[model samples]
Target: MLTIPSLHAALAMAVAVAMFTAFASNRFRVEIISLMTIGAIALLLYLFPLPGTNPKDGLALAFGGFGHTALITICALMVMGRGLVVTGALEPAARALGSIWRINNSLGLLVTLLLAMFASMVVNDTPVLVLLIPIMVSLAHGGAMPASKTLIPLNAAILIGGMATTIGTSTNLLVVSIAADLGMAELPIFHFTPIVLMAAVICLPYIWLVMPRLLPDNSPEAGHEPRKFIATMRVGTESSWLEQRIDEFREKLPEGFSFLREPQTLQPGQRLAAFATADDLREAGRKLGAVTAPRWLIKRLSQDSAKAGEDLVEAEMAISADSRLVGRTLQTAGIEGVAVLGVAQAPSRGFAAPREMSAEARLAEGDILLTMGRESSLQEFAQDQALLMLDGARPLPRRRKALIAVAIMGAAVLLASLGIMPIAITSLAGAVAMFVTGCVHFDKVGRALSAKVIVLVAASIAIGRLIGDSGAATWMGASLALGMQYLIPPVVLALIMLFVTLLTNFASNATAAAVGTPIAFALAEQLGLQVEPLVLAVLFGCNLCYATPIAYQTNMLIMAEGDYKFNDYMKTGIPLVVLMIVSLSVILSITYGL
Candidate 1:
C-alpha cells in the first residue's frame, strides 16, 4: 500500500500543490515565489534522491530548466516581437483592426478572435500569437480595447485552433506520434478537427463576450484622457491624397477629427489644418500617406537619425514664459535637430486656418509642441530652449527596416510551421537577424523580456521534470487506472480525461501526453472499449491546458502582456476548462458510442 517510491512521488506532488498555493495566495511576488520553488525542488531532490538515482543526478535534473529549449524559444520570440514593434512592421494590420474597433468594439474583437483561431490552425500557435501580440498592444495605444481584456482570449483562441490539427502545435504532434508508436492507427491532420470545431462553437461565445468582462482593465493609462493637439498635414507630390477632393479626403479621416478650414481640392504643397491627439494625428498622416513636417526637415531628421544609428522618438515640450522663442512663428522659430509635428495652445484657443497658421502662427508661452527626433536631441533642445519636457516620450517607427523585420519573421514562421527546422532554432536565428539588421537595437532588447516571465518559466520547467522523474506522474496514472475499472464506459472516459487534464494543467503537456497515452490505450483494452476515443481524450485533455500559465508556453507568453495575476488564470480559466471537459466528454461518448 505504501512503497518507498510512492512516498517519494507523494512528496513531489505535495511540493507542486504547495507551490501552486503560494502562487495563488498573492502574498508574495511571483519572482520570489518562483525562485523559492526552484530552490525547494533542488534541495528536496538532492536531500532525498529517488531510487536508482544519485543525489548529483537529482541536482542536475532540478537545475536543468535554465537551459531548456522551451525557455530559449520563448526568449527569442520576445526579441522578434520587439523587432516588429520598433520597426512598425505590423502597423497596417493594427490600423485595419483599429478602424473596425473605432466603429464597434464587439465586432472588432469577434473578428480578431476568429482570425487568430484560423491562423493558428495552419501555422504554429506560438508564432501566430507572436505576430498578433504587438498588433493588440498597438490597438490598445490607438484607443481600442485594452490589451489585458483581449490577450488571454486571443491566446485561448489560438490554443484551441492549434488543437484542431495534428500539426497545430508540437504537443499535438507528440501526442499523435506516441499513440502511433503504441500501435494505434495514425490519425490525419483533419481527422479529429470536426470534434474540436464543434467544441469551439460552444467556447467562442464565452471567449468573445464574457471573457473580456472577467478580466480587469489593466491599461497603465487608464483614467488619464489623452490631450488633443492641432497639427498641419503637409501634402506633397507623392501623397495619395494630393489630388483627391477635400470632401473625399475628409470622408477617409477618422471619426471626431476636425478640420480648421476645408480646401476645395488637395494639391502638392498644400497644408491642411487638423485637430486631434498626437496618436490620432500620426495615424491620420499614415492613413493619407502624408507627412506633418516639411519634407526637408523630415529628410534631415531621418538622415541624422541614420548617421547616429539611433531610433527616433516623439516628445512633448511646453514653452516657458521666459522662453526666447516666444512670439516667433513655427516657420521662423528655427528649432534645429527636431521636427515639430503638432502644437497645442494654452487656454483652449480655437483652431486657425492652415494658410493663417502656416504663414503667421507665432510660438507663445505655455504652448506645447510635439517634436520628433533622437531622445538625446529632444532632451538637449528642451534644456537649451527653456522648454519643459514632458514624460512619455514614444519611439517613432523605423520604417526603413519594417519590410526586413516582416520578411525575417515570415521566414522563421514558415520554416517552423513546415517542420523544416525546430521553432527554437528558427526563432533564435530571427532574433539574431533582427539585431544584425538594426530592426531592434541591441541595447533595447532588455525592454522586450520580463523578469517575471523568465523566473516563472524556469520554475515551471523544473517542476515538470520533478513530477516526471519522481514517478509522481506514473503513480497518479496507475491510481486513476485502478479506480476506473468499476465505472461505466462513459464515466470511465470522463475520468481518464479529467485525470489527464489535471496532470496537463499542473505538469507539462508533454509529460501528460507521454504518461496518459499508454495508460489510456491499456485502459481501453482492459475495459473492452474503443482505444481511439480514449487516446483522443488524452490528446484533448492535454490541450485543456487552460487552468495554469505553466501548462503551456502560449499561456506564459500572455502572462506579462496581460498583467495577469495567478488568480486571474484560476478565475477565468477554470470555468472554460470545466465547460470544455464536459462538452468534450459528451461528444466523445456519442461519437465513439461509449
Candidate 2:
C-alpha cells in the first residue's frame, strides 16, 4: 500500500528535485539559484513548520550554513592555500611534477593520479586535494596541460582513494562507527581497501584518458600562443653554471629556451642572449641561478618594496605608438622603480634578432615589455610613460616567508590527519598564522574565497538539513526497504548502493550515511542476507559523490579552477557512477559469496 507523504516531507522532496533541475539546466546564475533555494526553504519551513520546531528555528536551520563548520573549514582552507601560493611554498613541488609532465603528458597524469589516490588513503581527502590543486594550476600556467583537463581527473582519483580506507574521509568513519554501533563487526581500517583498489583498477583508465577529453580547455588564454620575449640572462657569481662551457649550459636549458647566438665560455657576471616566454624565462632563471635584470636593480627594488610594505609584482606594459620610449633602447628608457626584464616585438616581424640585440634592443611601438617592481610603481610608470599596462599583475613570490608558510601548513595538515583536532580548528589556526606571519596579507584574503562557492554551500547545507529533518530521507529509505523484499540479494545490494548514491549526491554524504546505514542493517535482517556487504554498499555509495558539485567539498573546490558548469559534472560523473555501481555490485557479490 502506498502512503501519501506529509506536507513538509513532500515539499522538501519537491524543493530538492527542483533545485537539482535548476542546477542542471544552467539557466540561472548559480548564486541566484542558490540564494533562491535558501529563500524558498526558509519561507516554506516558516509557513509549514516541522513538528516541534517554530518559525525562528526554521530560519536558523536555513541560515545556519554561513556559520557551519564545514563552510568555515573550506574558507580557512582557501586562505591557507592563498598563503602557500603568495609565499611560493609549492613551487619546488610544481617544478618536479612539471619535469615529469615535460617528459610525457600521459605519464605525468598517471603519476599524479596515483599520488593523489594513495595519499588520501591515510590523509583526509580535502587536504590532499588542497595540496595538489595549486600545483596543478601552476603547471597549467607553465604551459603544461590545461587545469580543466586535469583537476576533475585528479579530484576523482582522490575521492576514489578516499573511498579505500575507513579513515579516508569523515563520511567513511561515520559509516563505520554507525555500523559498529548497530551491532555489526567493527571493520578494520583496511577491511575494504582491497575492494576499492580492485574497483580502482577498473576506474583509473577512464579517469586518466577519457575524462580529460570531456573537459573543455578553460585556460584564460586558451587558443593564443604565449608571447615570447628576448631577454639577456646574467649568470650570478654563485651560479653552478659559472665557468661551465656555453655549449654545456645550452644543453641543460629547458625546452622552448634557446640562445640567439653562440657566446663565449660562461663566466661570473656574463650576460647571454636568450629568448623564451615570460614563464619559461623565469623557470630558466630559477634553474640556472641567473637574473634577467642587474642584481643591483633587483636588490634596490626589493629594498624599496620592503620599505613601502608591498610585494614585488611582474606586469606587462605595451609601448604605445605615441610613447616617449619608442626608438630608445632598454638601457636608456630610464624607467624608474621598475626593471624591464624582456622585450617582445610584434609577432609578424618574426624573432630574427640583430647582433647584440638583447643588450641594445630598441623599443618599438608594438613591443611588450615584461617588467617587475612594486604594483604601485608599475602603475605609475605605465601612466607616466603613456604605456598600456596589461590586466594581470602577478605578485612575485615572497620567498622569505616560504618556510614559515610551509611549516604552518604542515602543522595544520598533521594535526587534522592525526585526529588531534577537527580540521575546522586546525585550518582556522593555520589561516590565522598565515596572516600573523605575513605569508598572506589581510587585505588579500577576499581574493581567496569564491562567492559562487559560498552561496552554493549555504544552500546545499540547508537542503541537506531539510531533507533529513522533514522525514524525506526516512520516507525514501522506507520506500526502498518495502521494495527490496521482492528482489534478490545482489539486486538489493545494488539498489541500496544506488539509493545512497542519490541521497549523497543530492543531500550530503553525512546525511546519506546516517539515513542509509540503519536501512542497510534492517534490509539484511529482513532478507536473511549478510549485513556486511549491504553496509559496504552504503559506504561505497557515500563516496560516489561525483555527479554534482554540491556532492563534495573537493568538487566545489575545483569548480572555479576548472571553470566547470553543472552539466560538465553530470556529463563526466554520471558514467563513472554507473561504472562503480555495477563493478562494486559484482565485486561485493563475489567477495562475500552473496
Candidate 3:
C-alpha cells in the first residue's frame, strides 16, 4: 500500500531479522532454518508492496533458495564425505597416525592435531576429521588424556586446514566464485594457500600447548581418575564383613574411594574383581582389591585365544552421558559371557583421578573404555556396551574399490579446481562413481548428508540470498562502512572476515561467502580500496567457527566422542579467532598491498 522509501527499509529489516533469528536460536534444526529464512523474507517483501516488484514475485524469489546451487553443493559434499568414511579410505591413514599417539600422550595429541590440519589442506577436512575423531577418542580412553583436550583442538586444526585451499572446503570455493562475480580477478586454486599455511603455523603452538591445559577434563573415566579399576564385589557365604552396609565400605580406605555392588553383598575376604584393560590394570589388584582371572588363568586364556588365530583387536567406546551402566562392573554383568574383552579409561596428563574405590572402579558417565575382540566381535561389543564407537579400529570394505573411490575424488577435485566443472556437479558425479563402481552402497547415500548439516547449509543459503535480494546487504554495507572506512583498510577486511567466519560456523560457509562476499564487495567499493583484501576476508571468515560446538558438523561429531562442554570450545577457540584475525590481516595487507 505504501510507495515510501521506508517500505524498502522495513522489508530489508524484516529479512535481516529472520536470518539473525535463525542464527541466534538453536531450537530449530538447521535444515528448517533454510526454509524459514527463505519463506519469511519472501512474505515480507511481498506484503510490504514494494514499488517495482509485486509481493507474488517476491514470494517466489525468496523461496527459490531451496533449489539454490549453494544448497546442492553442501549436500553433495556431505555425501562424498560420507562415502569416504563408510568405505574406509581414511582408516589406513588413521592407523598410521594412531601409532604416533601410542608413543606418548602429549606428543600423540600434537601429532593428531597436526595431521588433522594437514590432511584437511590436501583433501577435504570433514571426512579426514571424521576419521580422526573416533581414533582420538579411542586414544583418549587408552592413553589417559581427556577427550575434551583432543576434540576441540582437532576440529580447530581441521578448520584451519580447510581455509588453506579453495577445494578444501565448499565455502572456500563459494567465496572465490562470489568474489569473481563482485568484479575481482579469478582466484587461482592455491591463491590463498600460503597465507593460510602461515597463519596455521603461527597458531600451532597455541593449539598444542595451551588448548589442552585450559580445557577441563570432564570424562573422569580417562586416566586422570585416581581410581583406576572398575571392579565387581561378591559376598562370601562365610565372611566377616558380609552384612556391612554401603556406608561403612564408603568410609574405609582413602577418601574418594567408592565400592559399587548391590547393598549388603560386599563382605570381607570375599572374591572381588575389577575390569581394566592393559592400560589401566596398574591399580587393579592393589587399589581395587580385585582380581583378574588369577593371572595364571588369563595367561592360559590368552594363549588359547591366540592359538585360535584371533588376537583381539581393541575397539574403544565412550560412556554415554546419563547412562544406566555407569555404576556396573564387567563380572557382575557377566562380562565373559556378554563378551566384554577388556576395559580402560581415556587419557589426560593433568587431569585429576576420581577418588572412588578402584575395585568398585565403577563406570561414571563419559568414561572411555578399551574392549578387545576380533573386528567383527568388537562391533558387537560396542553395540552391547551402549558405548559410543571411536575410530581407527574398524574393518575396511571392498579394498578393491578403494582405488576407485580415490580416483573419483581426485578427478572431481581436478575438474572443479581447474575450472572445467561446477563443484556441485563434480561432487555429485563423484558420489555416483563411488556407488556405481561399488565404493559405497545404493541404500545409504543419506548417511553422507547428516540431517543437521544439510539443514544448516540450506537455511543459511536461503538467508544469504534473502539478505542480498532484499537490499539488506547494501544497507548493512553502508552502515559497516561508516565506522570502517577510516580505519586501516586491512583491519577492516580482517574484522569483516572474522564476522563472516562466525556466521559461517553457525550456518554454512556457502551462506557466509554468498552473503558476506557482496557486503564486502559493496563496502570495498565505498572505501575506494582494492577488493582483494575484502574478498579474502570473506573467504577467511567463513572458516573461523571455533567459539561454539554447534558452529560446525565436525564439532557435533566430537561432542559424543570427546565428552566436551560448550565452554571447552570457547576457551580454546576465542584466542584462536583473535589470532586468525590479526594473522589474516597482516598477511592480506602485505600480499594485496592494502
Candidate 4:
C-alpha cells in the first residue's frame, strides 16, 4: 500500500494537474502542463522520498521515460506515417475508404470504424491509423460529413482492436513478458481474442452513431466562401494574394479579411463586377478588413439556379487590400477567404503561382500580384495595383506517388515482422527512406514530431513506472482480492482485468499496462490464479483508450481533425468505455474460468 506521504504526493499532483487542465486548451499551455507533471513527479520522488526510493531516485525514475524505447518508436512511426501520406503511398487506401463514402456518410463511417479495428488487429495499430487519418479526412470531404466526426471514432476502434492479440501492440508483449517473469506461461498470440471481439462488438455502434453527434466540426465555414464584399487594394509593386485561387491563398490573408468571392472566368482585361468605388475599397482596407481575391475570382463565384439567383450580398467584413499581406508568412496570415489572404507570384514556366509564400523559390518581377477579396473588391485591388489575374492552379503535384511510398512502408513492415530487425530499427529505417526518397522531406518532419504529444507520452510512461516501482499498485490488487478471496482464480483474474480497464481511463493505456501488468502478476501470485488471464486483463485495459484523447496518439490525432472539444470525448466515450468494462469483464470471466 502507498503510505501517507506517497498518497499525499499523488493527491497534490492530481490537484495541480486538475487546475492546470481546466484552462489548458491553448496548445502551448497544455504542453507546459504535461512537462510540469513530469517535473513534479521527479521532484517529489526525489525530494519527498516516496516509499521505495529517495527524491533524486524518484526524479531519475520519472526522467528515465524520456529515453524509453516506446517514445522513440512512436515518434518514428509518426514520421513513417507522414511519409506515407506525402508520397501518396496511402492514396490507394484513402481511395478505398472514399468509395465507401460514396455509399453514404453514416455507412461510410461505420465501415471505416470496423475496417480500422480489423486492420489494427492484423497490422500494427499506429501505422494503420496513420494511413487511415488522411482517408478519414478525404471521406469527410467527399461525403460532406465533417472530418471531426469520423477520425476519433476510427482511432478509438483501432485502439480497441489492438487488444485482440498478444502481438497487436508492444504493450501486450510487455505485459506477457512481465507475467512470464512471475512464472506464468506466456499468453498465446490469439489467447484472449474472443473476449476482445466481444468488446469490439459492444463498442462499434457507439463509435459509428453517437460520436459523430458529439464531436464539433471546426472547419464548417471552410468550404462555405464568405460573403463577397466590395473592396480595393493598391497592389504594391509586388503583392502575392492577387489572382490566386480563393482557396489557395485563404490561409495567408490577414485576419478580418474574409467575405471573399469566386472567379467568373473573365478575361484578364475584362471589367469585373463593380460593387463599390476604389475609395470605398481603400477605406475598408485601412481597418484591416478584406483583401483582393487570391485565386481567380471565378472559383469563388456562385452559380445557383434554384431561385435563378447568381449572387447576393451578405454582411460579414468590410473591404481590405494586399497591404496586410505584403510582408507576412502563410502561418501568420490566418485569413479565412473573405478576401484574398496573400500575394500571387508572377507567372512562370507553364504555371502561375498563388498569392502566398512558396518554399520553392524567391520573388521576381511582373508576376501577377494575386490579391484576395470579394469578386468586385478583388478586381478593384487588381486594377488599382496594376496586377494581372492568372488562369488556373497547377501548383501542387497531381500525380500519385503511391507505389514508391507504400513500397517503403511495406519493406519496413516486412523487415520487422520477419524478424530481420526490431520495430524501432525498421521504423526508423522507413522514416529515413521517406526523407531520402522525397516522401515527406526534411523540413516537414518537425511538424510531425508534435512536441505536445512527445511530452505527454513521456509523462504518462513515467507515472506508470512510478506506480509499478512503488508498492501502490500491489496494495491496490491485494485490497481488491481481500473481499473476493473465496472466488475461483479465473473469476478473480477477470475482475482484476476489469479493474485495470477502469484505471486506464484516468491514466493512459501504456501506463495502465506498465503499472497494471505487474500488479496483475502479484494478484495471480497471491490468489493462486493462472497468470494468463491476468496478462490478458493488462492488455485489454491498455487498449481501452476510448474515454480520452490523451491516452493514445491516435486519440490526439483525431482530436483536431474531429473538431472535438474535451467534453465530447467524455460523453460519447464514457458509455462505450463502461460497456467494454462490463462486457469484457464478464466474457473473460466465463471464458478463462472466472
Q: Rank candidates, lDDT, best first.
A: 2, 1, 3, 4
Per TM-score, the best of the predicted structures is: 2
Stretches > 4 Å off in candidate 4: 1-34, 44-60, 121-152, 165-195, 201-401, 415-421, 435-440, 488-494, 548-568, 586-594
TM-score of each: 0.77, 0.80, 0.69, 0.60
Q: lDDT of candidate 1 vs native?
A: 0.78
Off by over 4 Å in 3: 1-6, 49-51, 180-186, 222-396, 501-511
Ranking by TM-score: 2, 1, 3, 4
- The top-ranked prediction according to lDDT is 2
Give per-residue CA lDDT, model 1, range 429-508, as digits (tens).
Answer: 99999999999888888987767667766776676667666777566655666677677776776777788888777766
Evaluated at residue 465, the lDDT of candidate 4 is 61
lDDT of each: 0.78, 0.82, 0.66, 0.58
* Candidate 4 per-residue lDDT over residues 125-144, each given as its tens digit: 77788777755664554455
lDDT of 3 by residue, 272-360 (tens): 44443333342223333443333444455445543553333445577776555677864455454123433444442256675454433
Candidate 1 TM-score versus the reference = 0.77
For candidate 2, the per-residue lDDT at 443 reads 77
lDDT winner, 1 or 3: 1
